[model samples]
Target: MFGFILRRLLSGVVLLFVISTLAYMLLYVGGGNIARRILGQQATAETVAQKTTELGLDRPLLVQYIDWLSHAVTGDFGTSWFTGEMVSSGITSRLGVTLSIVIGATVITAIVAVIIGVWAAVRGGWVDKVVQGVSILGFAIPGFLIALGLVTLFALNLKWFKPTGYVPLTESATGWLATVTLPIIALAIGGIAGVAQQVRGSVVDALQRDYVRTLRSRGLSFNRVVFKHVLRNAGGPALAVLAVQFVGLLGGAVIVERIFAIPGLGQVAVTATSQGDIPMVMGLVVAIAAMVVIINLLIDLLQGWLNPKVRLA
Candidate 1:
């Protein structure tokens, strides 16, 4: 297990490096005349040249990449070209807001998906059809649409929540919950729809296994047999699917954040991309990539631990 975890960690590090390098190169090569963008459209060629040299854009690409990587390794992501603020500090300040929404959505997704999925599998009637319809709806409608509808219905018409705002948890737990409630629902609904389908399929297959019949014949109650044995075995795959969905939720937060006007990494990402902030963009990319790799590694280890066949093999 230790060896497996070690290997996964090393592989994740390598993947993050590759991701960061590619992102950096793409932004460096394709972001197009950063000095001109920084200096505005009216700047002369001489000013642009001077600005480029000052910003080290005249340096060899490899040298620039190395310097950026070295700085990143020490947690100095460098100052933003446009804002003149440390990129690391900028991200740190907003990290909590993003994490709050994503984490809350993940927990909600897990609970709702399991309950609905397990019930749909065990019952196998209209419940199954309902679950299928939900999955289709979730896949058909984009997340932005969902966010818009939610804001219109709950925030605008119903006046149950604010249309757009963020309150720090440090300020007031109630205010924070109120602010995140709609966004959390917006993120969780689609995630739940997808993961619930996976769980339903896994549970259905688990119910067909021979041991399930054996357990039933041994006078075990239906709930006990399903929960203690079947769900445990089925959960490994479902858990993996859920983990992947969590990553998707992070990406979708970009759109949701915009719709709701919540200040988060998503807003920063959009602004940085529009302004051609290479260092800021690279920092966001590397940070997101690292999170994905780490989450996947944790899921792999969890599956291995749950299924001895996986770890032993």
Candidate 2:
């Protein structure tokens, strides 16, 4: 296990390097005449030259990339050229808001998906029919639509919860809860639908196995047999989907974050791009890409751990 974890960590570092390099290059291409724009076309030659040197836009691309990579490795994410704040600090400070929404949604997704999914699978009559219809409805409705509808129904029409905008966790816990509640519901709606569908399929297949027949023939109680013997094994496949959905949300659903106006990584990335804050945008892109690679590597490890055949092989 230690060796496996070590390998995953090493892979993560390689992925981070590749991601950062790619982001740097892409930003360079996208940021047309950046120094000129920042300093203005009407600015004096001296001003343009000085700003260019300061931004290292005058340096060779290779040299600039190396400098950026070195600073990233050293945890000195450097100052945002646009915002003039330390990149690491900027990202860190706003991370909590993202965390609250992601964590909340993940917990809800798991609880709701597993309970509803397994039930629908094991009891495949009206339970299956109802679950199918609901899950399809969930998949059909996009998150932004759901979020808007929720805001309209709950906030505007019903006046149950307030519309979106973050409230800090430290001062007003209840307010924070109210603010995130809508976004979480928005994010979770699709995930639950997908997980339930996957679980239903996986569980149905698991129940048809020869071992399940043996258990039934042996006179074990239906509940005990399904929950104890079948569900755990069936969970392996379903868990993979759940892990992915968790990562995607936790890393920040950019669209949903924007719609709800949650000040998370996604929102920052958007703002940085719109303002052409290259350093900040590159930092956020690297962070998000690294997050995805790390999560995928973890899912690989988890899959191996749970499946005995894979472990034995």
Candidate 3:
């Protein structure tokens, strides 16, 4: 298990390196007149040149990347080109807001999906139909629309949650929950739809297997047979789906955060990209890539634990 975990971590690190390098190259090579944009249209040519040289944009792309990477490894992402804020500090301040929504959505997706999926697979009548219908609706509706609807119905009409603004958990736990609840729900709906379907299918397949019959013949109770044996076999695919959903939730949080007026990495990402703030953008790229790599590693570890065959593979 230790070896397996080490191997996964090594691969994750490699993936992070590759992603960060690609993002750096793409941003530097394709992003046009970053200095001019930062300096404004009225700036003189000599001024732009001075700004460019000051930013080390005049250096070779490879050299620039190496310099950035060297600083990045030491947790020194440098100051933003546009705002002059420390990239690390800026991102760190907003990271928690985005993570709260995404992680909360993921947890809700896993638990609710499992329950609904298992119920649909076991009952197999109106309950199954209703689950299927809801899954289809979930797939059809975009997350942003869900966010809008939730804001309107719950925040505006019912006065359940605040329409916009975030409260830090450190400030007040209940206030934070109230603020984030709608955004989390909006992000989680689609994830639940996708993962629930996967769970339902896997559970159904497990129920039809010969092992299920064997367990039944051995006089195991229905609940024990399903929960202990069937779910164990079916859990792998559901977990895989849930991991994918978690990544999607990260992307979805960008839009949801905007709608909810939450101060998060999403706002910074949009502003940085638009302004061609390479240092800030690169910081975000590295941070998001590292997160994805870590999430994938965790999923791989869970998969290996659930199915020893996965470790062999």
Candidate 4:
């Protein structure tokens, strides 16, 4: 297990390096004349040339990449071209908001998916069909549409939650919940669909195994057999699927954040992209990729713990 974890961590490091390198190249190499964008269209060529030199655009690409990587490793992502603010500070301030939404949605998705999936699997017939149908709808619908529908109902009509705004968790739990509820729901709906389907399918497959029948023959109650034997055996695959969905939710947060006007990493990323803020955009991309890698590693470890066969593999 230790070796497995170490290997996964090393792989994650390699993946981050590759992703950061590609992101850096796309911004610096492909972006062309960033100093012009930063200095505005009115700025003279002499001023632009000076700014380019100051920002080290004249340096060799290899040297620039190494410099950027070294500074990024130290959490010094440099200044935003447009705002002149440090990229690290911009990202750090918004990271909490995105994390809260993603984590809250994930927790909700896990509980709801497991219950609905397991119940549908046990009952089968119409229940199973309904769950599958919901899963298809989740895959088909866009998250922003769901956000708009939710806001129209919960915010516009009912006035229960705010339509758009963000409140820090440090301020008030109630206020935070009120602010984030719609965004969480928007994010969770599709995830619940995807995860519940995986769970349902896994549980259904687990139920048909000879061991399940053997447990029933030994006079174990149906619920006990299903929960203890079936779920434990089936849960490994569902956990893997859930982890994938969680990573996807981080990316999806971008659209949801924009729709709801929430100031988060997603919002920051979009703004940075529009303004050609390479440092800020690279910071956001690397942060999201690192998060995805960490979550996937944890998932693999959990799966191995649950299934010894996985550990051996």
Worst 10 residues of 2 by lDDT: 304-313
Looking at model 3, residue 176 earns an lDDT score of 98
* lDDT for predicted candidate 4 compared with the true structure: 0.91
Give per-residue CA lDDT, model 1, range 21-69, as digits (tens). Answer: 9888888889789999999999999999999999999999999999999
lDDT score, residue 219, model 4? 94
User: Which parts of model 2 have CA positions greater than 4 angstroms off?
Assistant: 41-46, 250-252, 310-313
Candidate 1 RMSD computed on C-alpha atoms after optimal superposition onto the true structure = 1.1
What lDDT score is found at residue 63 in candidate 2? 94
Shift of residue 103 alpha carbon in model 3, Å: 0.6
lDDT per residue as tens, model 4, 1-313: 8888888999999999999998888777778788899898999999999999999989999999999999989989898888888888998889899999999999999999999999899999998898889889987899989999999999999999989989888899899999999999999999999999999989999989999999999999999998888998998999999999999899899999988899999888888899888888888888899899999898888888889788677
lDDT per prediction?
A: 0.91, 0.81, 0.92, 0.91
Predicted candidate 2 versus true structure: per-residue lDDT over 1-313, tens digit per residue? 6666677788888888887888789889778878787767799888888998888898889999998888887778788877689998888887777777777887788789888998898888998999999999998887778888888999889888877678898879898888989888888988899888888898899899999989999999988988887777777888789878877676446777887777887778778887788888877777666667766676767766767554344
Question: Runs in model 4 with CA error above 4 Å?
Answer: none
Greater-lDDT candidate between 2 and 3:
3
Candidate ordering by TM-score (highest first): 3, 1, 4, 2
- Better-scoring candidate (lDDT), 2 or 4: 4
The sequence of per-residue lDDT tens digits that candidate 3 reaches over residues 106-171 is 999999999999999999999999998999899789999999999999999999889999999999
Return the clash pairs for model 2, or none: none
